[model samples]
Target: MIALVRHGETDWNAAHLMQGSSDIPLNDTGRQQARDAGDKLAAERDAGEHAWSAVVSSSAIRARETGELIAEKLGVPFIRVYPQWFEQHFGDAEGVPVEEAMRRWPNRDPEGFENDEQARLRALGALEQVAKDFDGRDVIVVAHGTIIRSALMSLTGRELGFLGNATASRLSQGAEGWTVHTFGGETLEDELGEPAAEIVAEVEPA
Candidate 1:
């Protein structure tokens, strides 16, 4: 099982700014949120509900910080950082207000911006890599909301909207492939069955 956690909120998130690859640190509230999330995970583990084997995070500062806090709380000794898990690069739209960014580049075609398909592919690849690396172990992955949402949408064909800061979404891998379940353990989707190649073919630049 892999639990995908969004990093805690930053000031730019509060301001509704585009923070794609911006390297913003968390605010005080964000730090508290990370600690609170850690506490919750610890409680779940203490109750023998789940045992987290490791905590892996994006190389971004905010995500790293969150993963560190969570790992500490869970008494997990190792934390790995993967650059492939970095948030989607918004290019010229980054660091601007969200509404203004949309108005300026409605199609996201301005130089430096990553298209949706590219972001989705990166997210998928990162998740698949992690699953392979930590086979048969439960892990926590700290990443950005957009990347998590993109991966979920591609796998489930459901637009889950923005994932809340420090919140987790659960995914599991088995012989049939990846299966996504709600945090409550309800089955949301299954039978993904190695769609990476299919996604690559479908989203190829045309």
Candidate 2:
């Protein structure tokens, strides 16, 4: 199983900014969210070692910080910079409203990503490399929403929407390769544990 957590909230995320590959620090609420999630994960591991064999995160400042904090809580080690987990490039839509930008140019990444197909291919290849690095181990991935979403599509045979901010997506060992327990969003733990179809809720910067 993989505990796929997204980085905490950023000012850009709060403002609905579309920051593809643009680094941003977490706002106060984002910090709190990470702390809360970390606490929950810690409580789960109170009995013994965490289920994760290893933890890895995007090298982005926000994601790295989140991964480090969560690892600290889970009693895991190693917080390295991994570029394969970076967010998707939005091209001309770098700092605009994410939804608005998507509406302006909703792309159908049938055989490739939204921008620079070659770069997208490189990113996919790198992701496979990182996954291979964690071969035969359950892992934790702290990354951006785009990366998390993309990974879900790759891991499972399903392509759902982007995750709600700071939410965790879970993939468990299943009859088939892997299965998505939940996408990123509030109420995700319950959703995963119970396997229900509820609307994904957003928890804003508090």
Candidate 3:
């Protein structure tokens, strides 16, 4: 099983800013959230459930710090940093407020912005690589919300809304391909396919 964990919240997150690719450290609440996640994972480990073999993290500072804390709590040996797992680059919108960023770059086409499709592909490829490398072992991945959500969209073709900080999702591989079992602790029962019409309509046009 592969568990994807979004990093703890940062000040930008609280400010409702577009934090794409901006290196920000976790805030006090974020640090506590990381500790809480670690405690939960540690409890599961102690109970002999979901024993994690390794912890992997995005190269970003927030994600790395969260991963380190979880690894320490879970007694995992080391963390592998994967740069490809980095969040989508929001270009000029990087530190801007969310509403303004959306208005300015509705289609995410601002200069230097990473295309949504490309970001999705990168996120999928990174997870696939990790799945292959750690086959048969339960691994934890600490990454950003956008990339993680992008990966889920690639799998389910659904417009899953923003994932909360420190939340986890589970993905598993089978003969067909990768399947999302749970997202933010909610178990998914349907097969992967195009998103619902309402969901598609709700998304702002690029």
Candidate 4:
């Protein structure tokens, strides 16, 4: 089983900032959230011991810190960096509040973000790679919310729009291929203000 986790909170996160690839750090609350997530994931590990074959994270500091904490809890060294794990590029709206920016750029597609076709391909590709790369083994990836959602949609052929924060999407490798976890949220759910506050006390079963 491969468990994918979104990174913990950050300054922009608390402020409702877009935070594209701005490289922000976690505030105290964010740190606490990561810790809680880590503990939860650790508990879900096999044999009552949270362990993983490998752990990967985005290059961003926020993601790196989150990956580090999870790796430490799982007793696995942070093993890889995936540039694809970076948050979707929000262009001029990087750190601005979503509503404020949407009002300003009502007609403009945010910068660096892929069009629907691109997002679909990227998301699916990431999911396939992550699910296949660590086939049958429990691997954890700490990434941004948008990235995870895209990947989920890609794997499941669901479509972009719903993935919540501080929540993980699980994928299992099978004879058919990579399969998406139903427990995770989608992007639009975040837009409606759902994911950011959901507390996942435990991730997998320990």
Q: Give the top-scoring candidate (lDDT).
A: 3
Q: Compute each candidate's TM-score over C-alphas.
A: 0.87, 0.74, 0.88, 0.79
lDDT of 4: 0.68
What lDDT does model 2 reach? 0.66
What's the TM for model 4? 0.79
Q: How many residue-pair clashes does candidate 3 contain?
A: 1
Candidate 1: the clashing residue pairs are none
Over all chains combined, what TM-score does candidate 3 have?
A: 0.88
User: RMSD of candidate 4 to the true fold?
Assistant: 7.2
TM-score rank order:
3, 1, 4, 2
Rank all candidate structures by their lDDT, best first, as comma-separated numbers: 3, 1, 4, 2
Per-residue lDDT tens digits of candidate 1, residues 1-206?
78899999899999999998999999888888888888888887889977887999999999999898888888896568999899999988888899998898888876798889889989988988898798788899999999988887777665555578998888777776667775222234322322322111122221
Local accuracy by lDDT, each model: 0.81, 0.66, 0.82, 0.68
Q: Between prediction 1 and prediction 4, which has the larger lDDT?
A: 1
After superposition, the stretches of candidate 2 with alpha carbons farther than 4 Å from their true spots are 47-50, 106-127, 172-176, 185-206
Off by over 4 Å in 3: 189-206
Q: Among these predicted structures, which one has the highest TM-score?
A: 3
Model 1: CA > 4 A from native: 183-206
Candidate 4 wrong stretches, greater than 4 Å = 46-51, 159-164, 185-206
Query: What's each prediction's clash count?
Result: 0, 0, 1, 11
lDDT of 3 at 172: 74
